[model samples]
Target: MIFLLSILTILNYNSNSIEINNAWVRPAGKGMNSALYFELKNSSANSDELFKVSSNAAELVQLHKTVNKNGLMEMKEIKSLKINGNQTIKFAPGGYHVMLIKLKKDLKTGNKIGFKFYFKKAGIIKADAVVKSY
Candidate 1:
């Protein structure tokens, strides 16, 4: 039946083609800066680029990379992060991460922060990152 076929298609599309796992944000004290880390997996046979990220808890959310410059660590804002088809990208400390700029409030452990990741091909993926104390 047409209805049955449509439902099946939708289910297949949502069946973890692109998934987020182990998402967490570092707890920041009074500082207005924070970082979020997660693992992104792309199971579909199409490459996608994460272009945008937004969060209500921060004034600005941007993709960033940590680079060592002159034996010093620096954070640089990047435009987008690419994830090839069937590839997994890890966003972790000392690597690629989401920079939460000008946080509205201090991040505390056991709290949840909502974020929306926009992909070029696969569309938008919403995730809640739990705040963790380091």
Candidate 2:
């Protein structure tokens, strides 16, 4: 009975938690910088904002969004991202992405990099980004 109660309490405590996954640094060739993609899930009762992103492998990191302008693909800066309660937001290619400017090192396939996420409500979350050829 005690263990069951403890489990319930823990679950309740974490009911408003947020999580991130599948973050990776895109593969790069000579003179080519990289971008990052990931998924953000928020189970909180309120929404959250992803204000900033940072990584050690890149000299600068910022949020970017892809838009169709005059039937052409264009990328622009995103000031923030909204995460509704009990919802997930995905950052992928041809959509919202993390722009990795000024490469510090080469990202090879099977390599993993560390990234830090800045959230308005959830504060900071860190995750390991894997390098893949996807």
- Highest lDDT among the candidates is held by which one? 1
* Candidate 1 lDDT, 11-104, residue by residue in tens: 6665358898999999986448899999999998767789888998888889999999999999899999888879999999998999998889
RMSD of each: 3.9, 5.6
> Which lDDT tens digits does candidate 2 get at residues 6-82?
78655664423779878877887534678999988897767778999998888788899999999999999999988
- Compared with the true structure, the alpha-carbon lDDT of candidate 1 equals 0.88
Worst 10 residues of 1 by lDDT: 7-16
Evaluate residue 89 in candidate 2 and report its C-alpha lDDT on the 0 to 100 scale: 91
Per-model clash counts, in order, read 0, 0
Clash list (residue pairs), candidate 2: none
Question: Candidates' lDDT values, in order?
Answer: 0.88, 0.84
Predicted model with the maximum TM-score: 1
Candidate 1 segments exceeding 4 Å error: 1-15
- The TM-scores, one per candidate, come to 0.85, 0.84
lDDT value for candidate 2? 0.84
